[model samples]
Target: MKTKRMNPFKPTAGGEPPLLIGRNRVIRDFEKGLDNGVGAPGRIMLITGARGTGKTVMLTVLGDKARERGWEVLEETASSGLCERLVSELRTKEGLMDKLTIRPSVSFAGASVSLGEAELSPKRMPETLRKAMAARLDILEKRSSGLLISIDEAQAASMEDMIAIATAIQHQIRERRNIAIIFAGLPQMVSDLYNDEVITFLRRARLNVLSDVSLDEVRNAFSQTFADSQMTISDSQISVAADVTKGYPYMIQLVGYYIWDAADIRDSWVVTDEDVKNGIDEAHYDLDNAVCIPELQGLSKTDREYLEAMSQSDGPSATAEVARRMGKSAQYAATYRKRLLDAYVIRETERGEVDFAVPFLREYLRKKS
Candidate 1:
């Protein structure tokens, strides 16, 4: 029997993907805050998840919704030098802040304003940036009903900047009642944000952590995708594919892509269990060859050993255990932990347990070891 061809299921750049299942609750929460007024203390939203868990997608959706509601939105990526760029951008746009009734205390002229002029000349650039931001927000309070700033990959932002931004938003801007900030990034983002001794921004902001999709949701989403293409697949087939992927968004799409293409090659009208099995195998191979191989090429021997040890374990190891296994002291293991986390090799759960954030990563590590 020939199989029916299916549609592609990869992420659509610059557009919403079909079968974007789940995340309704998060959308609603953001909408509720906007409706009630974002200027209320403790109204900001922070979305964190592993890479490819759709943090970017959620942020884009929220930005679209906010724009539809007549709110001014500024989207930027978190980076070491983002604060300076932001100040430069703000200064270049004449009366940009004026539209929202925000007036800059100091203006950028021929070159970007020095972090000093804005009363931000602290030891940390982020601190300086925060003061400058507060000054501008003070002006915005007069013009706009509210302002929303959306930042992606916010964990990359400097500790000083994170603290500065959080402090300004929580203490300085919250009083004015006209601004909201949303930060989205990998799971470590919250830890980085909280590391600032001066501010408890993570505590004050609402957390919206994206998790793996449920089996039922995954089945429905897959079935819906096929149905949208005027094709059909068996429930058992969908369930099997979901199990293989554990409902990770990227894996789901990867497997779906193979299944659809396989059906096209067979000229079949319906997907079967066998096709799902083949697709799962193909997806695993593709991930190993495309993602894992390239990342492994750059790792040092110690890094590889650390990853192997982590993969064999179920959760975060005790500092002492990891140190003993790696033949290093607890202090040395802690350093490796930070390096791995920074490279996205591992993640810490809410309860402080560490693990391979992506299931596929464990498989890759096992094969390598």
Candidate 2:
């Protein structure tokens, strides 16, 4: 039978390719925790990575899985007034009774709220929010078995608000065995969480740090995605595409999108090496003009210096090394490291090595250096 053509190169709302790879183990671990009571001592999981590393997508997938297991899910973003918006969303007239489903108890609210006649700002009342969150989870436990709260872009949240949120989770939520919280953000999220006095308690929560996609997985993902669309491409072409992207999820989609479009124009069902090359060139040009340039404009002088130094280094440098290179003190270099992390400009590897979080950013920094 003839197959239908589907585009494999479009960016989904969750910022992930339709096919996700190298995450089965992580997903299973989370599922096990939720199924077995959030682990022996109880824990939350933090998934951190660089920008465009599929952190958001991982959260969404996990949220979906949690729902299938009958856990209540609450999702919030870390924009401006997230806390106030969450309280208002949860405290509606219908309240917790209306948000539960067989799938999972799910609720969503923003950081801003519109009162009957005015807009209210987000606040940092840790104690109050703690109580409220506990109450909501209690209701979910009665209806479903447990509750899972997922927060995206958590690093973007205000430091004070993060502390308040962390306080509530550590103090109020920790007392209950029926709730779990999952936070996903950039690598700097760890620093932000550590700033809170209650962070030691928070650290008891589990941590899941995402990494880059593997070359083999990237090839299979792209090949399968296109195959499902009734298109055939040689392995060599797929490898070239993967090489150009370095297995970055966002770049994978960008390259695939253009290649599929090119094939459609020529009425060809097969993608060739030449097609892949052209697609990559197009993606690089577009990214340079759009995303890369704008991000460069946002960097401060210190950010640029740290990025250049790290790009030239073999691995993550200690505070002393970074400071010595810049003729500054270790303490001063540490501050710049935090800033770079907060800005999603750099990330730490498992071996305590640090490097540019985004490959395109590294390329851009190399050019400037």
Candidate 3:
């Protein structure tokens, strides 16, 4: 029996793909920002995209980069009470903050500190957060290091938390502190943040809108990754497989994962076109369930109808045609259209036309009808 190979591709969320495609520019600029000292525009990063576009992964990779440069990386999710959480994370840094406040000769032998997860009033949260964060940066400043804060799922983050984070970063910037923050959210939500007067700092930050990786990059990565795994796949076969993904970030991993699965089950190291076909079938099933299903969640009936109507078109659906299919006026339909666009479910194509943003979404919608 031949030795089995572990799959090189990862399809699950939070699993760092062995190969990162199409983000070299971001990585390069951010590392430069670390070296450029405080107030580099690259240090204030905003990553936005539709779901499955790897926004969270971008934060993780950047956090690793920051750690490599001796910066303390604080990772948090933008949920309710996020500012409160930030305070807790800062205080509980294993005496990292305490060391900065106390003298070097000071020793705490069996000294106990009572720091509970006390709820903070919204009005005072911002100030408290600023002080705590500044203390940490003060220490980093001494060592010529810095701090990098990453917040994911920022769309759901509270306005209060947003205000607090912005206020802290603004103070640090004014003081010329070596502080950086990365916010990852949906495009619509992040846009709203930028529009706010309090969060104007975000407008000046580096924006990374996640989208499809280039086909050439995806194809090359696919070939090299498989080759490194000791799997035999030709350049032509790789190109065909890469085309199937159309360069969507998550789809890249899903399709590659399934292709490897198909090849592995055959007990042959050589990947075949048939394997690609089988993989696409499996990948589509997963994509529909994983992506389409969640995307449809909480959509009103009219929203569902709008998507179903778009499915009737062979390509991009004319806005008027979609409205006609739904038996609604175009003016009435435009509301839902904007909603979908903001949510990244559908995007404007040519003038007066819209198309599904999610890959295989048309098939998924049609199947439901």
Candidate 4:
């Protein structure tokens, strides 16, 4: 018989967990940019990380802070229609549509419009979008506020939409308007997608490569969250639970969720060692399904082979050892290493040593093999 108590942990992708761990620096920097006003370097930022590393949650956190300081935030997921989505939001802001009296000469209704009138030719999209965004910015300027446009999954966004957005932002930059944009994606694809000359401004934007929290951060988060729920667990139990999470945000939340659930199922408020143990067991499969499976699914046979060979080592595997195990030359191994590094599936530890960036990936890979 389980209690009807609410679970404090959120394990879903992009979902804000009960408490954000070790993210004050990034959040504060973005705020410092907003506080400093126009043309601040941190105003334009690019965030890159492996899956479940809280990239989206950081976007959400930044959006909340901007709103608190009276800045309008346009949080969007990158896709083919990114420009269209951004333009749509800019066009429909209250009291804004009435101000943009149309030019009356409407040719084609696609992605180009003479301000506030949606739909026009692709060739004219950047122009119409710029004008609409300018109108919105003008209103914000009067209020001493600013605009922040954040795009997630930027790797998947089409180049055309990206260019259109870049062009509009470029115009605002030239005019020195108070505006900011953040783009988040897997580390591997960020450089290729943002390296185009047209969006060269992005090249100069601050780059933040997000990773995991320290074990101490995880320990404190677990202690605080559990204490808030009015549950009592010894420091040793908390340490055991925190160590099991290994500082991965997804597992942190997932393990905490099950720990709470384990207590709920026992119809008790006190969390026992058994509860923490059970939570770790249950969280492992859910983590694998949520993160590891999708990541492994994207690997090629060679990539899988490289990972499998690397999994033989308990810790970070040396590139030479991994290559020798595969009966291939180090040169052959270097290619897959770069691919995996770019994909953010594996990260270089020290010198030529590499380890799985995805948590519990070694156990999962070994189990599969």
List the candidates' TM-scores in order.
0.76, 0.77, 0.90, 0.88
Q: Write the per-residue lDDT of candidate 2 for residues 249-362, one digit (tens) a residue.
A: 767778888887677666788887677778888887776665567766877888778767776665555555667778777777788887876677666654445766777876
Which portions of model 1 miss their true places by more than 4 Å? 1-8, 12-15, 40-42, 92-145, 264-269, 272-278, 289-298, 312-344, 347-354
- State the lDDT at 205 in candidate 4: 85
Q: Model 1, 19: alpha-carbon shift in Å?
A: 3.8
| Residue pairs of candidate 3 with colliding backbone atoms | none
Error of 2 at 97 (Å): 12
- Best-fitting candidate, scored by lDDT: 4
RMSD of each: 5.7, 7.2, 5.5, 3.9
Greater-TM-score candidate between 3 and 4: 3
Winner on TM-score (1 vs 2) = 2
Ranking by TM-score: 3, 4, 2, 1
Query: Model 2: runs farther than 4 Å from truth?
Result: 1-4, 10-13, 38-43, 93-124, 171-174, 289-291, 301-342, 347-354, 365-369
